[model samples]
Target chain A: MNGLSLTDLTWAVPLPVVIPLAAAGLALVLWRNARAQGVISVVALSLVLVTSVALLVAADDGPLVLDIGSWAAPVGIDLVADRLSTLMLTVSSAVTLCVLLYSLAQGLADNNAETPVAIFHPTYLVLTAGVANAFLTGDLFNLFVGFEMLLVASYVLITLGGTGERIRAGTIYIVVSLLSSMLFLLAVALVYAATGTVNMAQLAVRLQQIDPDVAFALQLLLLLAFGIKAAVFPLFAWLPDSYPTAPAPVTAVFAGLLTKVGVYAIIRTQTLLFPDGRADDLLMWVALATMLVGILGAVAQNDVKRMISFTLVSHIGYMVFGIALSTEAGLSAAIFYVAHHITVQTTLFLVVGLMERRGGSTSLDALGGLARIAPLLAVMFFLPAMNLAGIPPLSGFLGKAGLIQAGAEVGTPLAYTLVAGGIVTSLLTLYAIVKAWNKAFWQPAPEEPREVALPRGMVGSAAALVVAGVALTVVAGPLYDYTERAAATLRDREQYVTAVLPGGRGEGRSADVTDEARREGGTDRVEEGSDLEDVGPRGGEQPAPPEEETGSDEGTDEGGTP
Target chain B: MIDTSPSLALVVVAAALTAVGVYLLLERSLTRVLLGVIFLSNAVNVVLLVSGGRAGGAPIVDYTDEDSMSDPLPQALILTAIVITLGMTAFLLAMAYRSWQLNQHDEVQDDLEDRRVAQRAARDEAAYLSDDDGTTTLEQEAAEVHDETGDDGPPSSGPGTPPSSAPGSHAVPTPEGGDAR
Candidate 1:
């Protein structure tokens, strides 16, 4: 294997998953001390961030795979880190760290009881570990495990204080997510039973050899599982209901991470295992519907949090549109869109939380005159709101520009429909944001008022996110390049396959043996007669091989070809 | 004996649960709605389980025959689903209890119409008072002010009541026949 020792393989792969998981365990043990848990959690996440960066640097040209305990091929547990996964890990870790800090500040300012504060750190650490695991895992079943880890942590974080509103929202969130997880599991089982393998690389190799009809069924099942998680079209009703009810930091992290995981899985599955672009036509239409329906929901909401939540649903359509196209540019655009949306959407939600705090309520009727009293808050809210609406000089605009450009490249009637949907959704999002601004800030205060104060830490956290949103906009060019690289890597599986299985090239050469060894061992092998009986003739002299060798190779190959 | 397939039976059960859940969700009682959510979650779980296909054999490692292994992926997935549902159920129960305690009732009503009516009445009262110019008669003004303030002061000048100084003082309605007047 490329003359590498076991030490290099062991150190390279497991750090990203292990650091946060170990920290989670440690956090749980120290759960009684809130401050200690917070410190430990932050340090753990920071380490994850460093490891993700290191992984990206180390895997510059190809993916990295680790088989746990040195087990070979399909039998072992594997962790794979491709460009897309590394990028996701980096972004997730960064966003999670910011949210963790925000939560700590919020807990201190609100003087939340000790128990809930203590629970927050451990759960947050687990959630981080889950996100890392989901991105890094090479097995379908392992992905499911990662998803469950994150979902459970999110449930607790969402319902931590157990207020009536939070509990209600958390209930809906948990039920919907649970349903999706079950679907994912069923899909994995079906695939495993059909193929007898779950390793993504091996599955990619084997699935292409299966029957067309069976492959189609497997593809559909996988789509449904990821679709439910991603909140595409008919599957998205629970998002708006549950997301807005949580604390601002929790909602921010959810907005940033949860749905994006679904998108990541979809990208991986579609690009790697199933490259039939036509199969995604159904998804394109569903993407359009998701965009239209979500924005309409946003238009109907009076609560600030719920409106943002609905808008989150609407923006998911943009990413789906990119995936549906199944082209290099399309995938690149989708990746860029995901990164931009995570920052913009999370910032907007956090700002909404700030608005709620300053105005004494999230309801439009209870809020007004915020601009007169809190211009900084208004500016923070205004920037992300405008960005989310795809205003110029913002990351949101650049992401949409890339998507529309990709849509135009496809040059189909359906493509036009998606473009139209994108435009309409953007307009509706603007309308929603403006409605919130007018009612929450620009209008005069109500006749009778509840006195409200904006906490310094809350403002600070929001400011940090707003700056991040702006930075994304400013660095759009570089970000696009990075995403394009990731997209290219996804489109060309050769680099990935070779990276995982060294010596994948050169047929007839033992993959585990070096060229030097082959040269030295050549003398011993020359004495063995060449078996020509198994080698079939190509309109030339007949080549022969033993019956066993000929029969097994053709048999397995025939069964494998879909 | 019934000849239905297990997959079909699972589908039927899911449908029934979903219908019941939807019906309960429409009810005004919060507790009923919570129960409805629980049923709906169970229905979704059943749907997931059925989607894996009919039961086959156990998915144990080292099994030689492929057909003998039932899909283990669904079981693993359902385990997580069960845990998530438990968390949700607990949260819903807590929320329902809290709502009951706060309102002393378990029902949630659509309050938009009632609130609208109250707003309209308040606006009408304000408009009625503001219609006249500054030259309101003393007795009429006093009566209007008393209505606005929800006071029950004396109807005429007496030991406890101040005498009206304006020329239209007699216009004030007497307490005994105020509505008749």
Candidate 2:
């Protein structure tokens, strides 16, 4: 165990969450000043981005741990920042920062300069905090709390303008989310009933000991709860309806990030708690159906926002496919796909926001000759649209390539079908984007404005995001390597369990995993005999792998140069 | 099933509440749906209680006579769930009230676009199911979809449709009124 007194637990672990949370409280008090709100939101998100990047760097050596109130492992709510979480946090914060800039520009353009909607800043910050918390939390209960934070903030964000449609859509969104959360709560209760502890680390050990039938049933409940949130297959009815009606920036943020949070939670629980890939055949079927059916729905839509909303639902299948495979390559590709999708998705939505501003509509039928009018907007839309549709040399294609490669490696008949389905979805996504393009950008001026003036900041934000999407390609090699290492960590479920519950077997259980036993130099703050050692396997003479992942120097070469 | 009596009673209550709740959820009325959600959530809470498996003393054991502590965590989880459910229910109530103020009823209306999309989907599915496999482009299908009820096609230029509930750049209801049902 990392020997530590109360003082040993520190800020490095919780900074990403705490910074925004504290800043949100500050923003709430300063809500009267639009300038203050904008500055506060921007600065707060910037801090989060920087801290998340720093956390990602720090986590390379080992998983960073912060036990609140100094209550150690399985007993207290611990926050862990390992490779997967910090990667998500970093990308999400960057997207949020850009979105904040875009929204501030929107406020200025809307001529609400003085009244600059106070609620948006605080609520947005809270939502970010909730996401960060969900990523970092070490227990199921705290994960539930993290989800509620998201709901509270999202409910406010979804209905910010108080329009009839926004409210109506929000009602559907909230009701669906509430139902999912209720299921999640019930799942948690059952978990506590089955295992005496709510800590994920402890449950990992205990769940294995429970009857296979009981474990499988519990797994299904958890899957069902998160599946709705992730908008998988039959559970996805609410997303397309609710998402398209929000104000453009809100819709953009929601599109870019929200469902990914659900996906992240699913990945964590599936990988950490249940590694056997239970009913994986069923999951692959669901993934294929989700991909094919969702794209068909996207094809049916004529509006840009609605089309993207449908695509958002569809792409979730890709990540789910990775999860279903339950291979190291599959998990790694899933992580890569998530990051790639987030950037590309957010950029496209921001472009939609711009298109809505310039042409006065996102309805494809009502829009034409946008390229002639606003070529910059067209380029912004073009690159990401191509990227999203899996055009070559872009991150989207790269991500799909990785997933398909993984699927090929799996080589099962079902996996082959999903790979084929994935290719179909990609083509349909491109087709959907092109349909929007023909109507909104390329067609002769059915209704072209004499002059076009865009909010500079908003355009800048969108451009920045588009570049970030491109940068994913630029650094695909490194990012893929990182994902591989992260996936490697996930693949060795016992590594995580042992890391979280040190000496988990008993008082004198020697470190069995050789790799973990070797990295003593990097281990810090492990206590020799903390009082919290009452449960689980015991003694460790040699230090544990303090650095979570040893450098995957080979991954760089294997991933191939970008 | 150590505490068979209460667990059995609770299970029955859960089944009944969930059944009624689900039945009410099928109604078009928003209030009914809201009530159903509440009932469903409450039923889930009771089920959560039963999952704790038994009733015993406090979970605190000082190592003397430690048999069972009634698993206080589920009770705690149930408390958190209740608070969250209350928050959600209150929000639902507010939405219902607002809908009433706007439309004079809380009967949820179908999204016009969603209905159109579904109709198109059914048509496409039927087309796919048929042996011909016509291979109609999705763009063609999307463009061809028109309300058979004598309404103008979307990108609607009818000059009568209110902007209300029309999701577009111009979300605010403007006097430019240009399309209608």
Best by lDDT: 2
lDDT of 2: 0.75
In candidate 2, how many Å is residue A451 off? 3.4
Kindly list the per-residue Cα lDDT of model 2 for residues A1-562, writing each as its tens digit: 2334232223667877787889899988986676887788888889889888888876666566666765556556778888999999999999999998998887887643111267788889999999899888889989999989887889988866555566667878887887788788877866765655688977776677656566777788898999998999999999988887777778788887789888998899888888877868878988998898899988877678889989999999999999899999999999999999999889988899888778876666566789887998999999999999999999999899999999999999999999999999999999888888887887665544556589899999999999999999999999999999999887777766765664432222123332243343124213311211321121011112431121132123223421
Where model 2 places Cα greater than 4 Å from the true spot, the runs are A1-10, A112-116, A450-452, A504-562, B1-6, B58-68, B118-181
State how far residue A65 of model 1 sits from its true place (Å): 1.3
Question: Highest DockQ: which candidate?
Answer: 2
For residues B33-53, write the lDDT of model 2, one tens digit per residue: 888988988888876676554
For model 1, the local distance difference test gives 0.69
- Chain B TM-score for the candidates in order: 0.57, 0.61
TM-score of every prediction relative to native: 0.73, 0.83
The per-prediction tally of clashing pairs is 12, 22
DockQ of predictions, in order shown:
0.03, 0.16
